[model samples]
Target chain A: MSIVGEIIISALLLVGAGFMLVGSLGLARLADPLQRLHGPTKATTVGIGAILMASMLYQFVGHDKISFHEFLIALFLFITAPISAHLLAKAYLHMNRTDRE
Target chain B: MISIALAVSAAAISFSVVLNLWRLLVGPTPTDRLLALDTMVINSIALIILFGMSYATFIYFEAALLFAMVAFVATISFCKYLLRGNVIE
Candidate 1:
């Protein structure tokens, strides 16, 4: 890769790292449990995704090897995260319903 | 090329984390927090994969896979606990 490209890649990685840090910080700092949850789900997700993509790109361009595992992981995450979240929410709602009765 | 892709994806993941964080901070119920935690774990798995690529090693990928499996089980247990007030019940 060209020096310019390397510089750009590094810059992007730094930005992604910053995002992850910020997200984690928010998660730790948020007051309520509900509020704390948002930080990792949104900001941290993007941060981690960017970093993973960068890794894949690096391997593809620099090493000239086919890479698909990360994609698979991404797919798995996209599918499962929502489902788990839904289940948890449902359970919480169920608990609340029982409590109110 | 791979580096660029990794960088972009990382940035995208970061955006996702921020959005989830917003939801967590403003959530009105405990369920919302739990949901966010689930999301975070998924994101972390992705991050581990990226780190593996960055380091040019397969260990990170293995770790990620393990995390994914464990996370699923953990979520199930937590959800069960939430519903029945006991993990085994």
Candidate 2:
């Protein structure tokens, strides 16, 4: 791979990893589940999205064939994350709807 | 350099998974546990794809895709149970 492509891939991997780290930190340290939910939903999506882009780009630069499957995973995650997050929130409220916070 | 980067990212992601597991184990509420489980699924998916990238294989790609689908279904069913007290009613 060329130096520029290498740089981009490395950057994506590092940044994605960093986001994942931060998101997990939030999950562990935060006091509330609702607040903690923010971390995994947004950061994981963007983080993994970046990693997927890096993978697709790496394959494009390093291999002869084009691959769209990486994007397929990203798209699936993007669509699912919000739906799961929303439903999780609803379930949480269904149990604790009387509490004021 | 690529290998080094892959190793570092893999380590970081694994640490993140460990943390997610911590939340899963010690979450005060069932909802919190489910949230952690959902997040863990995404983390594993990312790690699996990262593995695919480093190993230069296409088969892990299929596993990653299928895993996502199954995890999504599992999350929905678990949430349904939480909301309705039954999954298939």
Candidate 3:
């Protein structure tokens, strides 16, 4: 890989991982479960997205072969993350109401 | 430089996971625990992808795909049980 390509891959990976760490930090530090939901869904989505994009580039530029399968995982995560977060939030609210009664 | 970045990324993510674990154990409510679990799932996925990058192999792709599916199902089921009072009902 050229220096440019290498730098791009490294940048992507570092940014992705940094976001991942930050998301988890939010998860740990946030005051409420509902507030915590924002961390993984939003930040981790971008984090993993960046990481996947970096992987795709590394495979194509370093090995001279283009790989598209990485996109599948990214797509799946993007689609499912919101649904799960929604469900979890609803459940939290539902149970919280019951627990108080 | 790439090696250093990868190492640092991995360390950061691992520390994040540890932080998530702490939250999971200290959960004041089940929802908190569930959220922690969900966060861990995503964090692990990030870690696996990074591992794949470091090794320059695509094999981790399958594991990552399967984990995403399983995590979704697990989250939905956990929520379903709470919402409906039964997992399948």
Candidate 4:
């Protein structure tokens, strides 16, 4: 890979990894489950998205092949993450309501 | 340069996975545990992609995609079960 491509990939990887770490840290330390939900649903998803973007760029420049498979995975993840988070939140609220009543 | 970045990122992700495990173990409620499990699935996907990059192979792409699909279904179904007391109606 060229120097420019390498630089971009390095940055993406580092940033993604940093976000992932922060998200997990929040998940482990947060006192409220609702607060914890924001960490993984938002931060972790963005972290993985950045990593996937780096992978796609790596394939294009390093391997000299254009791969859409990474894009497919990213698209699927972006589409499903919100739906899953919503469902999980709703389930949490329902359980809380039932427990209190 | 790229190799060093990859190694560092891999280490960070591994640590995050450990943190997710910690949450899973001590989470106060079932919802908390489920959230941790879901986050762990995402981290697993990140690890798989990093493995593919390290190996310079496309085979793992398919595995990652399948994992994402399965993880989504698992999360959704688990949520449904929690909400309704049954996975499927």
Q: Best candidate, lDDT-wise? A: 4
| Each prediction's DockQ against the real complex | 0.27, 0.84, 0.81, 0.90
Q: What's the ranking of the predictions by lDDT, best on top?
A: 4, 2, 3, 1
DockQ of 4: 0.90
Clashing pairs for model 3 are none
Estimate, for each residue in A20-69, the C-alpha lDDT of model 3 and write its tens digit.
88888998898878998899889988988998898889888888878776
Please report, as a residue range, the 10-residue window in candidate 4 chain B with the lowest summed lDDT. B27-36
Question: Better model by DockQ, 1 or 2?
Answer: 2
lDDT of 3 at B67: 93
lDDT of every predicted structure (CA atoms)? 0.65, 0.88, 0.87, 0.90
TM-score of chain A, cand. 4? 0.94
Ranking by DockQ: 4, 2, 3, 1
| Candidate 2 chain B minimal-lDDT segment of 10 residues | B34-43
Scored by DockQ, the top model is 4
List ranges where model 4 is wrong by over 4 Å. none
lDDT of 3 by residue, B1-89 (tens): 66777788889889988988998999977878888888788889888988887887878889998998998899899889889989864
Candidate 1 Cα errors over 4 Å, as ranges: A93-101, B1-54, B85-89
Docking class of 4: high
Say which prediction, candidate 1 or candidate 3, comes out ahead on TM-score: 3
| Residue-by-residue lDDT tens digits, candidate 2, B1-89 | 77888899999999999998999999888888887887788889889988888899967888988999999999989999989989997
What digit string (tens of lDDT, one per residue) describes model 1 on residues B25-57?
766676765666666666667566666665678
Per-residue CA lDDT of candidate 4, range A1-101, in tens?
A: 68999999999999999999999999998888888888888889889999999999999999888989888988998899889889988999999999999
Worst 10 residues of 3 chain B by lDDT: B1-10
TM-score of 3: 0.96
